[model samples]
Target: MYQLTLGQRAQPTSPCGTSTDLRGGPIPAQPAHPTRTASSPARVGRRRCRPPPTDGYEGRLVGSGLSGCRGGGGGRGGDGSDCIDALGRLLTRILRHMASELNLEMRTDGYVRVRDLLKLNLQTFAKIPLKSHTVDEIKEAVRRDNKQRFGLLEEDGELLIRANQGHTVTTVTSESLLKPILSADEVSVCVHGTYRKNLDSILHQGLKRMARLHVHFSSGLPTDGGVISGMRQSVNILIYLDVSKALQDGMKLYISDNKVILTEGFDGIVPVKSPISRRHLSPSSIREAKP
Candidate 1:
């Protein structure tokens, strides 16, 4: 039989009534996989539990901090670090790519019932062990995602979740993405931060999506910490977006729930003819921005 060692979690009070689907139809939460634990095995006729993968996958348990994980449950160090990070990665993949796989609408908002996500993680899509996580832990992982990738929704009192941006599926509309362009207008400038090494390529080829969808940009550099998510070493340059020009040119620019400005995709993987301002950010300048 399959073996599951993850600890138990208190199921949140799921309010009654089905949530409205993309078409406003009722879609209720009907979980395919019930919670399992090492102490309590599934029935003899049921599926056998496979032990968690021993590789780094088991090194971290992502959500709903359980008591039975490696490195003593889900704090910030040891397995906790690995667990949350894995959850982030796994969720990102699923959010950005699951529409076609799951037979979902292109712009259906990428809303997956929490229970369905857990079932998918435990069975279908997972290739590693340590995929176990509780709904609470999943929620925590969403909260911790640095790029503001995932967004939570409570529809008709039924909790639902979705990716904030970076969707290849066109089923979603700008209104569904929300935050409004008026909000985008309030920003003095939006910025894209990248390492200094890529400046030449970017200047020549422009910032390409490479894969997935959307060209991610930060609304602005924060006063503390590194601007945007991935910045290696201490040196990087900032590319200021011409938001007004982009909008005027009819480019479909969007702001992620996390305040990052993104485009559906750039033409020819190069920036628009829109006027973009550039600046050199030294190590000292970044340090000075910090509180």
Candidate 2:
């Protein structure tokens, strides 16, 4: 919930202007470094650091400014840490809580208008001290998140943005959501990890979507990069999905672009624990908890 002030007004201030600290106090200036003479040995091999983008022009242009274009690099446009973080928080809060308020049809594919989001105000963002954001700043936030939570796309020459998944609102009409687990055998090992304490209740009551639209699972654990599905890493209890049985029982599942497995448990699915289910826990927890 940090207040990120990007693009300070063109008023009297230093060249880079001043960045504020958490306490709303100005950050102290750094001690001036000694100027190096032309003969200084250190200057021989030193590479120059690029100053941050002014008015958003950059060596990496497509990914900078308000153009809504794409390019390569380490997923940054410039020294934009504060703006990106603010936009990211703003995007998630809206898509999850206020997506439909602005009259967009969000789908399982996660496409919405970048311009619409940029125009969001404190009313939508729980009144987070929002300043105006540009299209590029929003896209830069999407790239830095790297979770694929939000994305940018081109449709009929217009640029749009969306939350990748984990939507509690906004109906998704993506092709993936329309299809069932066509090859259950290929997804035979899908699983969800949880803390050791939840095993007893989970084993008794079964996994539920709870507040979310679906219960997320990964193809494997985080080391494999599939099961990272936005869960905490310390999870020890692994809930294995019997996709075959799940489909056979008339349940549905969707696979996200990021390879995360998703399911909205069948109607009345909660309270109906599977009698024939597969689950595992870390070896160390086996002795500490019930089998």
Candidate 3:
């Protein structure tokens, strides 16, 4: 019911004069998508096969001295060119694999990682300005390009960035967000209600739970309540509760170990440091020391 052409199922010829498939398997009855006729002079001249071009990507490839054979320079040229094209296709496959494995969303200006590139032997395709460039030079070039595109630079050999806004907002370190709340001593909790009845109920509940601590409620949101001020041995706590006809407010609690010092509206857990003491001197000595 099915028919196959000889050229369509022909196996590719290996350099060793044996038929081979693309995966190095035994030669099939026909070649896949044969570009050259069987009687074509190019096929009998020992020229290598060129890989088909891929869509949406472009690159160049170079070969080492081993690519050429003795005599027949034209044949060598054709073979070398074909080898380069094949290498380019392989490199493209590597890039695709890296993008998929690393969860990298490739943009027109974006690039693959140097580690991934090296793993795929992609440095071979990079056109070095000099005929002989060192490995370090290639690495540095890749690093510089990656940093410029990603907006993150290595600081003291560490990758550091204030924020990365790719799909979600991500902070460089936890200290950026957690420090303020951890270093507070006395927190003022404020509650507000849209209606008078709701305010009265909230105030009564606050009084029942926190008789010793100061609590306040008003018709609108509290303004001066979130501020944590001069806390020695941080002992105060702040709780805010809001109830309305539309949404229910949540409750939260905080615990501290060190003295919380709230200054300039920033809260953070501060470590103890050596205190500065005033130097003692006699009145006559102080007068003599004055210039």
lDDT of 2 by residue, 1-291 (tens): 011111111112334324442212233333333575554322111111332122432344444463322111122444445335545765776665467765655666667766665554431111122324566666677788856676578888878877666666636653533245666876645666565556567657667666567777766655454343544344555555667667676667777765677777765233334443333434433322211
Which structure is stronger by TM-score: 2 or 3? 2
Candidate with maximal TM-score: 2
Model 2 backbone overlap count = 3
Report model 3's TM-score to 2 decimal places.
0.18
- Can you tell me which runs of candidate 1 are displaced by over 4 Å? 1-81, 102-107, 121-131, 169-175, 182-184, 222-235, 265-279, 286-291
How well does each candidate superpose onto the true structure, as a TM-score?
A: 0.59, 0.61, 0.18
List, residue by residue over 1-291, the lDDT tens digit for candidate 3.
001000001122343323543212233243243474553322211113442232211211133332211111222233334333323333333332234444533433223333333332122221111213333333333233311112233545533221111111121122321223321133332221122223234233322222111112221112223322211111111122222210221122221111121111112211111221222333223212210
lDDT of 2: 0.50
**Following a full C-alpha superposition, what root-mean-square deviation does model 3 have from the true structure?**
29.5
For candidate 1, write residues 1-291 as lDDT tens digits. 111011111122325435532211233443344566764322111111232233433435446264223432223344455455556656665666565675533335567666566655232212223235566767777888776678887778656678876665555665666455544456655555554456667665677765436666665555444344322122245555556666665666666666666665446253633233333344446433310
In Å, residue 249's CA in model 3 sits off its true spot by: 41
Indicate whether candidate 1 or candidate 3 has the larger lDDT. 1
Model 2 stretches with alpha carbons more than 4 Å out: 1-78, 101-109, 123-131, 173-179, 226-230, 268-291
